[model samples]
Target: DPIFLSSFWQELFTLQGVLLHKSTAYHPQTDGQTEVLNRTLETSLRCFCSDSPHTWATQLPLAEWWYNTTYHSTLKCAPFEVLYGQKPPIHLPYLAGESSNDMVDRSLEAREAVIALLKLHLTRAQQSMRDKANKHRSDRQFMEGDWVYLKL
Candidate 1:
């Protein structure tokens, strides 16, 4: 499908800041990151707008903030922090009184949080894989005399 004519497509391309492929019908995995990001965006939108579907326009900014501020397990940093060296300002009205000094502190906190989150996720994933490997090794039923057809 042509995207140049669509403002939605233009905005997507601009925001992504890179050229994206138009994947073949049965092999969408060629654009895996785009697919993953789309899913993430949709999930963020849905979760943020659950209480006000009709007013989701107002929730998009917050959703974007959350997505950009949170650390990505694979990227090793929050999207915004990776791109800008600092997380973008979150639009929370309750924190409107924050000063420039406060922002400096907040950015430091955000960086630490991102690092902690990444470490936690990495630890959990490694532990899960180790557990699965141990279980598989323990459950093996091979016998010394058994003839097994191992596929090469």
Candidate 2:
């Protein structure tokens, strides 16, 4: 676990513009997003490798791909779209009458539409999350040196 606090990991996150926050021990809720993603990943792995549990590792990439491309309730858009500004294309079997040029054109058009939709979804999702969080938040304030019990 100490390895996670090493300079290498810290530098890696810094380069990616990620801030690593250490959560309280035994408090998974403190990192709610990670907990939810982990649960989703587990469910995806189960669905993908139910018949061959030993092959779960091999199916991990596919599961991750599916998870990223799937729409999330909180985000209101696929994670892939939010990050890349477009939905990832699924490989479908070519139709007998479809030309490569047509496929390419359709793909580009679809990407544009996905990016537009993702923008709207992101705005709505942010507002929804803000409202939900505010609903349960307390107005209590604590100043420096104020006595507070730390949960162990």
Candidate 3:
């Protein structure tokens, strides 16, 4: 993790005009969204590297791509699309619909239908994930100076 704070990364970010804001340590739920995303990514890495733990560093790019291109219910679009104003050119295997034609038709109607179906599937998947995550969660409120345990 120290590599992220190294001079090489700092120089690259500076050359690209990117700003890096460090997060505070020992803070309690200052940014719940970030906390949730970090937990999700950690679980993903655990599963992905469970077999070959040493290969995780090499697999990070693939994880990042999957996250960026996946539908975010809150955003209503993939993160990549929001940043680029267009969908990322990721070629997933064509769904085996009714049948396949030797010659593909490059028509607007076909593209529109495909986009619509994709949107529907992504929405459903998002709902499913939300449902599963909320199943074990409860509405809990804590006040200042409440005795609570931190997971660290």
Return the top candidate by TM-score.
2
**RMSD to truth, every model:** 11.0, 15.0, 13.6
Q: Residues 10-63, candidate 1, lDDT per residue (tens digit)?
A: 788879896755566656478777678768877766654554568557556656
The residue pairs that clash in candidate 3, if any, are none
lDDT scores of the candidates, listed in order: 0.67, 0.73, 0.69
Of the candidates shown, which would achieve the greatest lDDT relative to the real structure? 2
Clashes of each: 0, 0, 0
Candidates ranked by TM-score = 2, 3, 1
Order by lDDT, highest first: 2, 3, 1
Candidate 3 lDDT, tens digit per residue, 1-152? 57769999999999999987766766536767788877766655555565566866755565577678889999999999999999989654444353355335333334434445545656877999999999998988999989987878
lDDT score for candidate 2 against the true structure: 0.73
Error of 1 at 108 (Å): 23
Which runs in model 2 stand beyond 4 Å of their true positions?
1-21, 24-29, 94-152
Q: Which is better, 1 or 3, measured by lDDT?
A: 3
Model 2, 1-152: lDDT tens digits are 67779999999989999998888777778998779878878876665555567877866776688788889878889989999999889746433335568777665554344344545656877999999999987798899999997779
Stretch of 10 with least lDDT, candidate 1 = 91-100
